[model samples]
Each structure stands twice: as C-alpha cells, then as structure tokens.
Target: MGESLFTKVWNMHKVKTLSSGQDQLFIGLHLIHEVTSPQAFAMLKERGVKVLHPERTFATVDHIVPTKNRQRPFQDELAEKMLAALESNTTDYKISFFNLSTAYQGIVHIIGPELGLTQPGMTIACGDSHTATHGAFGAIAFGIGTSQVRDILATQTMAMNKSKVRRINVSGKLQKGVYAKDVILKIIEVLGVKGGIGYAYEYGGEVIENFTMEERMTVCNMSIEGGARFGYINPDQKTFDYLKGRKFAPQGEAFNRAIRFWKSLASDPDTHYDDVVNIDVSDMAPMITWGIHPGHALEVSKSIPALNRFSVDEKATAQKALEHMQLKEGQSLLGQKISVAFIGSCTNGRISDLREAAQFIKGKKVHKDVFAFVVPGSVQVKKQAEEEGLDKIFEAAGFSWRGAGCSICLGMNDDQLVGDQVCASSSNRNYIGRQGSPTGRTLLMSPAMVAAAAVKGELVDLREVI
Candidate 1:
C-alpha cells in the first residue's frame, strides 16, 4: 500500500530518533507572533543561544496589538512590552519581522500563506493554535507551545511523536450559502470534538479538491477544534497557482521546477489510512456554535441539543455549555440577540472573507442594537479591501472598519465583549471567556453569517439574507 502524505512528509523531515523515543523533525518554516514569542526569546537570551536558521523563521505582531489606534508604544503596557521584545529579539537574531508599518503585517497564519512562505511538502510550526491554517497548502503544520517555540528557535528542530492518519472525504457540491466554515463545522459535529486525538486529518474528495486556497485555509484552521494535532489537503493546481508569484516562492525557471516537486508531494491514489470519514456537502447548511465548545453547534434552523441528547459521557459538558450560554434545552439558536459582530481573525480574516461579508451586507444597515466591526487580516488585506470599496460597504452599513491584527478574535487586545453580550464572531474559538469578558458569549460562524446576524439582530439564515 502507498504511504499517506503525513507519513511521507514526516519521514522526509525526520532529522533523527531521539533518546526519548520521539522523532526529531526539522521544521521547514517557523512562524512567530508577539504573544508567544516574548518569553521564548527571553529564554534564548538567558541561555546565550541564537536562532539556528533565521532565514527559515518569520516574525509578526498580531495577538495583542490594538486594531483601532495602532501607534508606537501601545496603550496596553504589556502589549507594548511584548512588541518591543519581539522587535529587539528579531533584530538580534536577524530574523525577518513584519512590523505594523509593513504592508505584510497581519495574523501569523494569514501572513504566512499570503506571502507564500507556507508551501507544499514542508513542515510548518507556529506559536499559535491555529497554525494548522497553513496546512491548506498541503504542508504538515501544527501549533507549538512556548517551550517548543524555544526549541525550534534554538535548534530549528523539535521532537514529536507520530500520529495516525485519518482521511476525511467531503464529496458532492456545496449548496449556495454553504461555505468552507460550514463544512468544517459539520465534520466536527459528526466526528465529535475529540475524535481526532492521536490522528492527523487528511481532507480530500471532490469538494475539498475544488476549494479555493482561502476556503481550504478555513477548513484546516479549525483542525485543532476537532482534537487533531494537524490537518492538511494534498497539493494541487490551486496550491501551485497561489504560490506562483509569492515573494518567497520560486521565480522564472525555478518556478516550473518547484511545481514539479510540489505535485509529487501529493498522496498516492491508493494511500493507506488508519481511518476514513465521508461527508456530503449537498446536505450541509451554514453552521453556528450555540455553546462554548466548537463541537457544540447546530444548523441555524436546528434547536440546541438537550443534555440527554448527547452521549452519557458528553452530558455534563453539554449542560455546562448550555448554562454558560444562557440557552435552554431544545431552544432554537435563531433569534438570539447579539451585541457585537466581529469579522476578522486568522480563521476568517482573509480578503476573500471580508469581500464575502461585504457582498451580502452592502446597502444593508446593521441592527440598531448590534455593534459591528470589520478588521482586515493584514495591512495588505486592509488596503485591498479599500481598493475594492469593501471598506466603504462595511462602513456605510455601520460596521466599524478597524486596522489589522488579531482584533476581537482571541480578545487579547482592546477589542472585547461585555458581560453576557452575545457576539457573532468569525474567529476560531467560542469557549467561555475567550472573547475577554468572563461571561461574554461567542457564536462562531462565517463572516457572511455574522453580518447577517448583525443585520437581523438574530441568527438569521444566510440563505435569507443573501
């Protein structure tokens, strides 16, 4: 039997077997952001170590930067300190840094792909959980903790245990209003949150193959929510096309050679897998998380699951989510009042996501009670949106157009939710206290869905709005 792409890439990057019985894998690309790298860089200085491969590493600020007023010496003292540390450390280590002034600056995940630093047949690691977002390019990418961040920076390699591979085949054509976000939510809902433990998810089938690079990024961005350490789709034409003119990608004749190599990185037709899952896109609807956990979601038209409806093992968790969300059993997710609508994050902060939301909300006003905002993924995305008049559409609809950063996504910056105020968020997580306030409720949905909810002041169907 042929080997899966996971095994193929893992073996290709293996440096050595460590005494601890783990594979010492060399990371082809290392992505760093402000929040997690400060401590790691401090540790490196204390130990008198330099970044082994500065060329392979890239740095940017996102997690804690305020999107509204981004002047030097940030208003948040801690954020200012982190930014200073990152700037000094990157300069000392000779690593390329995407500071705020640079047009390339954005969320680490978004910056990596848009710059083409993320490519097929490579290993990618970042200090952010959504680092899996790079897997859209058919690379093996996953999140690393602070300590592991230090490890990669010091030696350019980290030890990891092997994981089983599971093939998630999504077939058929997606209906209108259904999106990549919906498809991923459906996968998590069917497979449960922890179904991917000890496994690497390999997404394939007609629907996946047909997805644009942005859509694939959306699917791979939430692999961690499904308990997968990593996720990827095999490289294809879309992958090559996206990388063709990227700054880091090969140029001239080198480009042709790179495509040949990338094409070979795809998994063989008869590749073996530990497990397989199939989903039909035709039956899918736009999804929203009605509770804390990402898997605790339902279709817009469906009601919240009762405690008894879940497996006995899941009842306690389900009940907790329902209670924290202030939702009752069997109550429909529709008609939930939202106080805020956020349209940017690594998960859905790409230019395409912004345009999609703008397309539906143009000329429509936000609900009187809803406070809405649109944050581009990077300065580049912000500029592009302005060029296409997307910024005007949002601002005209009363959606505050803020600067780039991880604004309102993980809520480390000034952007946050107030007590018990529900938010229609395009960010990754919907966990309790994830949006800053301890009692803030976040409902994860596509940017367009979030806009619809903001307009209707409820979880209205995207089909109705579009």
Candidate 2:
C-alpha cells in the first residue's frame, strides 16, 4: 500500500518520540496574530527564553482591528495593547511583522499563502483555530493553544498525536449557483459535527481536483468545524502555479527544484486511508446554517430539522439551537428576513471570494432594512479588489466597503452585529454569540449568497437571484 500525504508530512517533521506517546514534531512555519500571541510572548519573557526559530515565524495584526477607523490608539485600549505587544515582540525577536503601514498586512491566514510561506510537505502552526486554513497547501497545519504557542516559540517543536486519515471524495460537478463554501457546509452537515473527531480529512475527487487554489483554501479552512484536526488536498499543478510567483516562494531555477519536491509529496494513487467517505454534489444546493452550529445546515429550500427528526442524542442540542435562533422546527429558511449581511473572513475573504460577491451584487442595491458590508481578508486583497473596482460595486450597492481585517467574522474587532439581528454571513462559524452580540444570530452562507440576501433582505436561493 502507498502512504498518505498525512503520514509522509508527519514522518518528515518528526523530531523524536516523547515519553508521553506524542511525537515531538518540528513546525516548518509559525504564524502569529495580535489576539493570541501576546500571552505567549509574555510567557516567553517570563521564562527568559528567546524564540527558537524567529526566521521561520511571521506576525501580523487582524483580530481586534477596527476596520472603519484604523487611526492610532485604537478606541479599544485592549486592542491597541495587544497590537503593540505583537509589534514589540516581533521587532525584538527579529521576526517579520506585517503592520498596518505595510500593504502586505492582512489576516494571518490570508497572508501566509499569498506570500508563499505556506507550502506543500510542511508543518504549520498558529494560535488561531482556523490555522487549518493553511492545510490547503498540503501541509500539516493545525491550531495550537497559548501554551502550545509558547512551546513552538521556545523550542520550534511541539508534542502531538497523529490522526487517522480519512479520504473524502466529492464527485460530480457543482451547479452554477453552488460554491466551495456550500460544498464544505454540505460535508459538515452530512458527516455531523463530531464525525471527524480522530481523523485527518483528505478531500479529493472530480470536484475538488478541479477547484482553484482559493476554492481549495475555502474547503480546507473549515476542517475544524467537522471535528477534523487537519484537512488538505494533495499538491498538484494548481498548487504549484499558485505559489510560483508568491513573494516568499523560490525564484528562477530554485522554483523548479521546489516544485520537484512538492510534487513528490502528493498522495499516491493507492494510498491507504483508515476510512473513506463519498458525497455527490450534482444535486447539491447552496447551503445555509439555520441552527447554532455548522452542522445544523440544510438546503435553502428544505425546512429546518424538526425535533422528531433528530435522534435522541441530538434532541437537546437541536432544541437549544432552535430556541436561541428563535426559529421553529419544520420551517424553511427561505424568505427568512435578515437584518445584516457580512462578506469577509479567513474562510471567504480572499480576492476570488470578493470577486464572486462583487460580480453578483454589481448594479444591485442593498435592501432598505438591511445593513451590509464587505471586508477583505487582507490589505493586498483589498487593493486587488479596488483595482478591479469591486469595492465600488459593493459601495454602490449600499454595502459598506471596509478595510481589511477579521471584521465581523469572529467579532473581536469593533465590527459586530446589534441585538437580535439575523445576519447573512460569509464567515465560517454560525454559533450563537459568534458575531459578538450574545443575542445575534448568524446564518452562514457563501459570499454570493450573502450578496443576494443583502439585495433582497431575505434568505433567497442564489439560483433565483443570479
């Protein structure tokens, strides 16, 4: 039997077997952001230890950044302090910091790939849970806690237990209105939230293979939602093409040499996996999450799962989700009114994502009762969208064109929904309180779907609008 990419990357990065039955694995790339790195850096200072491999690490500020007015001395004192700590730590340790003054500044996940720091056959770690976003490059990327971040900063290696590999194949073509975001939501819905507790998801098949690098990133970005520690697609021509001219990627003949190594890291045709799953998207519709968690999603035309339809194990959670969302079982989310619409996040804040939404909302107007906005994942993405006049499309349609950062996605920043607002969000999570307001309800959908919702002020099928 051939080896899976997960095993190959894990074995390559293994430093030594620890006494606790976890392998001490060397992290090839360490990404940091303002929110989580402050505590880790303070611990490093307390322990009198320097970063083990400052050269391999990079820092940026995204969370807690006020997208509307980014002037100095951030209105949120804590936000300003966190950003200052990150700047001081990165500068003192000689690690590269992409600050607001630089065009390269943006969300941590968005910059890593654009700069070519994330590549195939490597181990990447970050303090954010969505660090799995980097696994789109065929690397073993996973989120680390504060303590784990300290471990990587001090030793450049952390103890980890390997996961079983599950090959998931999504066959057939996506409909005109469906998108990568819809695909991932469908996967989580079918497998349930806890279906991937001990597995590394390997996505493949006709649909995934044909996906652009950005599309693959969108899919890999949400692996954690399905309980998978890691999710990835094998490196391919599309992967190499995307990385070729990236800022940190190799240049000239070195690029060819790197590709040779990257090509070797792809899984073999007969690679063995502990388990396999198959889903067909030929009939898949654009999906939206009607309940609290990501798994509570149903097709827009379908009604919410009634309590009677939920298993005994799920009844309590289903009931709680419905209650918090102020939604009734057996009610279709179609024509459900929304108060807000958000387009941006690590999951769908890339340039391609922006373009998709921009194209759909062009020459359209936002609903009179809805408040809508678009936030680029990074400054570079924001620049690219402006160059293509995407920002104008959004602004003309009554969507607020805001600066790059996490924005309303995780809601650590000033951008947040008001009380009891139902938001059509392009961000990953739909958990209650995820959008800052404890009473805010987030309806997870694609950027295009969010655009449609903003235009109509209700949950309408993309097919109908587009």
Candidate 3:
C-alpha cells in the first residue's frame, strides 16, 4: 500500500512521539503576523529565550496595517504600537520580516506561497486560523495559537496529535460563474461546519485536479470553516510551474532536481484514507454567506434560511446572526442593498482574483450608493495587476484601488464599516463585528461577486453580470 501525502509529510517531519501520544513535529516554515506574535515574543523575552531556528520563521504586518494612508505613526494608536513592537521584535530576534514598505509585504498566507516558501512534504505553521492556506502545496499546514507560536520559536518543534485523512473528491465539471470559492462553499454546506473534526482533508478528483494553484489555494484556505485543521491538494505539474520562477525557489539544474523530489512527494495512486466524501461540481453555484459564520451560506439566487429550518442548537446561532445583521428570515438574498464592496483578503486577494473582478467591472460604473474598493493581497499582486491594466479597469469603474494589506477583512485597520452598513466582501469570515462595526453586516463571497454587487448596489447573481 502506498502512503498518502499527509502521511508522507507527517512521517518525514515527526521528531518523536511524546509520552502523551502526540508527535513533536518539526516545522519547516513558520509564518507570523503582528496580531498574534506580539505577546508570544514578549513571553520569549521574559523567559530569556532565543529562537532556535530564526531562519525558518518569517514575519509580516497585515491585519492592522492601514490600507488607505499607510503613514508612520498611524492614526490608530494601538495599531501603531503593534507595528513598532513587531519591528523591534523581528530586528532583535534576527528573523526575516516583510515590512510595510517592502514590496514583498502582504498577508502572511499570500506572501508565503508567492515566494515559494510553502512546499510539498513540509510542516507549516502560523498563528492565524487561515494558515491552512499553504496546504494547497500538499503540505501539512495548521493554525497555531500564540503559545504554540512561542514554542515553535523557542524549540523549532511543537507537539500535536495526529489527524486522520479524509479524502474529498469533487468530480464532474464546474459550470460557468461557479469558481473555486463556490466549490469550497458548497463543500462546507454539504459537510456542515464541524464535519471534519480531527481530520486532514485531502482534496482530489477531476474538479480539484483541473484547478489552478490560485484556485486550489482558495479552496484549501477555507478548510478551517469545515472544521479541518488542515486541507491540501496533491502536488502536480501546476504546482511545480508556479514555484519554478519564484524568488525563493531553487534555480536552474537545482530547480529540476527539486521538482523531481516534489513530484515524488505526491500521494501514491492506491493510498488509503480513513474516510472518503464525494461531491459533484456541476451542482455548485456562486455562493455567499448570508449570516455570521462562513457556513451560514446560500446561493445568491436562494432565499435566507428560516430559523425553524435549523436544528435547536443551530436555531440560537442563526437568530443571533440575523439579529446582528438586521435581516429577517426567508428574505431574498437577491437585490439586498449593500453599503460597501471589498475585494481583498488572504482568502481572495491574489492577482487572479483582481483580474476576475476587473473582467466583470471593466466598463460598468459602481452604483452611486455603494463604496467599493480593491485591495490586493500583496505588493507584488498590486504591481502585477497594474501591469495587466486591471487596476485601471477597477479605478474607471469607481472602485478605489488601495494599497495592499488585510484591508477591511477585519476591524483592526483604517478600512472599516460605519454604522450598520451591510458589506459584500471577498475576505474570509463574516462574524459579527468583524468589519469594525459592532452591527455591521458581512456577506462573504468571491472577489467577482463583490465586484458584481458593487455595480448593482445589491446582491446580484454573478452569472448575469459576467
């Protein structure tokens, strides 16, 4: 019997099995951000500890970087403090950091893959929940907490219980307007939010196999929403192509040798999995989350689910999301007014996402009542979008082309929701108060969907707009 990719990576990185039965896994790459590392660094400082492998850790500022006007001594005092702390910590600890002024700087997840730091058969860790995004490269990636971050920094290894592999195969062809974002959303809807507990999801089949690296990242990025600590696609030709010319990737003859190893890291054809779930790609639609949780979603053409339709445990959660959103049950998601439209985040902030949105908004004007913006995931993505004229299309359509950062993805930055505004956002998470307003409503969808909504000034089917 052949080994799965998860097992291959896990066995290679496992240091030893602890008495508690957890494996002390050595992390090949550790990504960090300002929001989660401040306290962890402080803990290390107090304990007189030094990073065991500072070269393995990379840091960047994203969550709290002001998108509009990124001047030093930022308007937000707390954000300024966090930025200063990260700068000081990284400098003092001799860790590599992508500062705001660096062209490489952006969301931790976005920068890691773009630089080819994420590789097959690697154990990757980060403090953000969406760190699973790197799993698209066939690595075992998981989100670690602050304490674990400290442990990784101090010892280069962290203890973790093993996760069973659940192979999710999506076959058939995806219809027009149904994107990678929609595919993952449909999976979450079918499997429910907590379906993959204690499992590492392995995505395969025709649909996943045919997807581009960026598309795979979009799908793997949201595995956390499905209750999976990690999710991945087996490495293939597409993966090798994306990493070939990257800055951190090996060069020339060495690159060919690396590709050979990368190819070998793929799961064998007959690898066994603990469980298998199949999905039909033809049934997926352009999906959006109508409620607080990413799983509380419906197709743009569908109506909001009624409270009575939910289980008793889900009823309370649904009602709370409705109350915070100021929405009624069975309401039509179509034509629901939107105050803001955001097209950036670690989840959907790549150059590909910008191009997709620009294609739909090319000649159309944004609705007068809507405030829409396109914030790229990284400085590199921003430069490429400009080179491709996507930035012009967005700007001509009345969408503000802002600097890169986690703009409006969360409430930490200057970009925020005012009053009880309802935002159509491409960023992950639609949790209440996530967009800087306690009562602000967030409808999570793809970058293209957000652009379409901006033009219509409401929720509209992307198929019609496209």
Q: Using Cα atoms with residue i matched to residue i, what is each candidate's TM-score against the true structure?
A: 0.99, 0.99, 0.98
Model 3, 43-156: lDDT tens per residue?
999999999999999999999988889999999999999999999999999999999889899988999999989988789999998988999998899999999999999999
Give the range of the ten consecutive residues with the poorest summed lDDT in model 3: 278-287
lDDT preference between candidates 1 and 2, better one: 2
For each of the candidates, the C-alpha root-mean-square deviation to the true structure, in angstroms, is 0.9, 0.8, 1.2
Off by over 4 Å in 1: none
Q: Identify the runs in model 3 with alpha carbons over 4 angstroms from their true place.
A: none
Q: Poorest 10 consecutive residues of model 1 by lDDT?
A: 300-309
- Candidate 2 lDDT, 359-453, residue by residue in tens: 99989999999999999999999999999999999999999999889988889988888899999999999888999999999999999999999
Give the Å shift of residue 312 in candidate 3: 2.9
| Tens digit per residue, CA lDDT, model 1, 263-335 | 8888888888999998887867789998889998778878887677899888988889988999899999878
Off by over 4 Å in 2: none
